[model samples]
Target: MTILSDIPRLLPEGMALGPALDRALAILERAGFSAVIYDYTPVPRSHDGSLITPNILEARRVPEDMLALWKSGFYQLDPVQDAALATAAPFVWSGLGKQSRVMDEVIRERHRPVLGYMHDMRFSFGVTVPIHQPRGDLATFTAIRIDAEPDFAADAAEIVPQIGVLGQIFHDVVSAGFDAETRRTHHVRLTPRERECLSLCADGLTAKEIARRIERSVPTVTLHLNAASRKLGARNRFQAVARAAHYRLIEAAPAA
Candidate 1:
C-alpha cells in the first residue's frame, strides 16, 4: 500500500497538529525513511510573539538530542530553516566534515548550533515540504533517514505535491472546525421551546403543525422559529435549517 492509503485512517477529530503529522511520519518510516517533521506556521508574528508550533513531536526512531534541540528553539536560528523560509525549495545537506555548505554557515554564524551539533551525532537523509496556507501561513514536512540509508529527496519530490493537495483539505476541514468552535463558544441561549420549534420547522413542518405536535399555539411556534432564525443570522426558515445542519446543531434528518 502507498502512503496515501494511510491518510484516511490517520486523521481523527480534534488535536489537529500532532496526531495528523505523526501519521504522515509513520507512513514515511514504513517506506524506509527515518524521521519526519511537519511544521505549520500560521503567521510570522504570533499573538504573543513566541514561536507557535515549536517542535510538536519527535518520533522514537529519530535522534533523541535532535528532538531536544528542536524543543529548545534551535530552529529559530538554523540557517537552513531561514533559507527554506526565504524560499520554498528543498535540497540535500551533505556531511558537515569540512563540507556541507548549509551546516558550515549555520555553525560559523552560531545562529543555532543545533544543526551543526547534529552533524557529529546522526547522519540523516531526509526531505522537507513547505506547505503554504491560503491565509498565508507556512507549514513544512521533513522526513529524516536513519544511518543515511533512505533517499528522502527522491521520496519527497514524489510526495510533496501529494501533501500539497492534502494541505487544501486540511485548510478546509480546520476552517470548518474553527467556525464550529466559535459558534459553540458564543452559542445563543435559546429556550427549549424555541429549539424544538426550530428543529421541527427545519423538518418542513408548518408553524401550525409544529404547534399541534409540541402543544403550543401557532403564533407561539412562529415566534420561536422566527427568533431562532434571527439568532442564527439566517434570513428565513430554510436558511436557518441549513446553517444549523452545517453547525451540527441539528441531526441530518431528511426533509419531509
Candidate 2:
C-alpha cells in the first residue's frame, strides 16, 4: 500500500507524458523490474471481437524489434492482451512456462510464435496490468523483470494489487492531456443526434418510439440511425446500436 502511495509523489510536477512515463519506469525499477511498456488504445476491439489498431504505444528498456512487431499486428497474437481483456486484475506471466488452459490453448492453437519470440529475447518474466477506462479505452501497463530466478512469478503475483493502483494512477495523469481524442477515433464519429438516436435504439425502442421520445419525425430518426450505422461500419441500425454500445459511444443500459 505504501509502495502505491509513493507513486504520486514520484510522478512529474505537470504530469507530462514523457517525464511521467520516465518516473513510472523508475517506480517499476524500484519494484524489481527492468523494462516497461505502456500502451493506450482508443478502440481495442469491435463488437464482433476483431482486433482494432492501437493509437499510442510507449516503452522503455525494451528491444526496438519488439516495438516494431507490436505495431505490425503482433498484438493480435499476444496472450497477455487476450488475458487482460478477460480480467481487470493484474497478472504475472512467464515467457517460458505453461501458464493456464486458456493461455496454453491460445499458444497451441495460435500464439506459439509470439511466446517463442519472448523466450529468444530474454524478456521472459513479467507482469501486466490491464487498465480499462470508463469510456472504453484500454491502457495496459507492463513491466518486465529480465533474468529473473525461479520464484519471480510468485513475488510478482503477491504485488498485483499495488501494481494495479500504480498503473491506474499513471494512466489517469497521462490521459489528462487526451481530451481531444476521447469521443471519436479517426475511423469513426457519431453526431450528437446520431448518438442520441442510438442510445435510444440500444434501449430497445422502435424507430417510431424513438422518434416520439426525442420529439423528432420518424424519417429524421431514420436518417440519424442510418448515419450512425454508416459511421460505426455496421450493416444496419441493430448492428449500429450494438457496436455503439460496445464502443461506449452510447448508453448501455438494459432495455426497460
Candidate 3:
C-alpha cells in the first residue's frame, strides 16, 4: 500500500514535531523512501532579517560537513530555497540549469560537494512541498529518490497532504509554546462554567442540550460557549472543543 494510505497506522499518538517527523519519514521509507527532510524558514525577525530552520535532524543523522554548511547559512543562497520562498504549493527540481544565473555560482562553487554526493549516490530527482503560513513564513518537505523510478514521484505525491497536516500541527505547537507531548499533561485553567459548557459541547451537545444538562437556559449556554470561544480564539463550537482537547481542558469523549 502507498504511504498515504498507511498514515493512520504510522502516525504516533503525540503531536510533537520530532515524533511527527520521524513517523512521516518512516512512512516514506516503508513505502520505499530515498531521503526525506522537512525544511522550515521563518521570515527574518527584522526587515532585513535572516531565515531559520530549527535543525530538526539529529547530529548523527546528517553528514557533519553538510550540517556545518547549513549552520553557516550557505543554504540561504540555494535556489531551492528561493523556489520554496516564491510559492505556497509543491514543486519539483531535478537539477541546476546552466542558465539559472542567480543560482549557478552558489551551486557550482559552494553547494556542489553535497549535490555531487547525492548525484553519485544515485539520488536523482526530488519533490519539495512548501507549507506557507499567513505570516509570510514557509516550511518545506523535500523527498528525494535514488534511482530512475517513474512512479516514485506519483507515489510520493500521495503522502504530501498528510505531511501538510503535520506541518500545520507543527506551527500550532510552536505558536502555543507546548508540543503534543507537553500538551497531554497541560492544564488550561478554565472556569467551572466554561469547562462544563465545553465538556457538553464536545459530546455533540447543542446549546439546548448543554443548557438542559446544566439546568441553564439555552441563551445562557450560548453565552458561555461564546465566551469560551472568544477566550480560546476559536471560530466556533467544534473548534472550541478541539482546542480544549488539545490543551487538556476537556476529554475526547467529553463528560456524559
Predicted structure with the largest TM-score when compared to the true one: 2
Residues 1-256 of candidate 2: C-alpha lDDT, one tens digit per residue: 1356556578744587788878888888766888988888877886667566566778888877987897787877788788877777787677876474445444445677778778887765777889987767788998888777777767776776787888888888888777656435544678889989998888878999999999999999999999888888899888888788777677756645
Off by over 4 Å in 3: 6-9, 44-46, 49-64, 95-122, 147-256
lDDT of each: 0.55, 0.77, 0.58
RMSD of 1: 12.2
Per-prediction TM-score: 0.49, 0.74, 0.49
Error of 3 at 65 (Å): 3.5
List CA RMSD, all candidates: 12.2, 4.3, 12.8
Cα lDDT tens digits for candidate 1, 1-256:
2556645566545535555556655666666666665544434323232333331233435656666677567656555455445555554443332323443444446553655565765645545455555544555556565555444445545664555455444434333344433323123345567767777877778888998998989888888888878877888889887765543456545754
Q: After TM-score superposition, what is the CA distance of residue 107 in candidate 2 from its true location, in Å?
A: 4.6
Clashing pairs in 1: 35-144, 37-142
Per-residue lDDT value at 162 in model 3: 55
Q: Rank the candidates by TM-score, best first.
A: 2, 3, 1
TM-score of 3: 0.49
Q: For residues 1-256, what per-residue lDDT tens digits would candidate 3 score against the true structure?
A: 4345644455534455566666666655675656666554434222223344332422222333665676566554455566566666655555421222333322345455555555555655556666676645456666656674776666655765554554454445443444444323222346779978998888888898888889999999989888888877789888888776654566646244
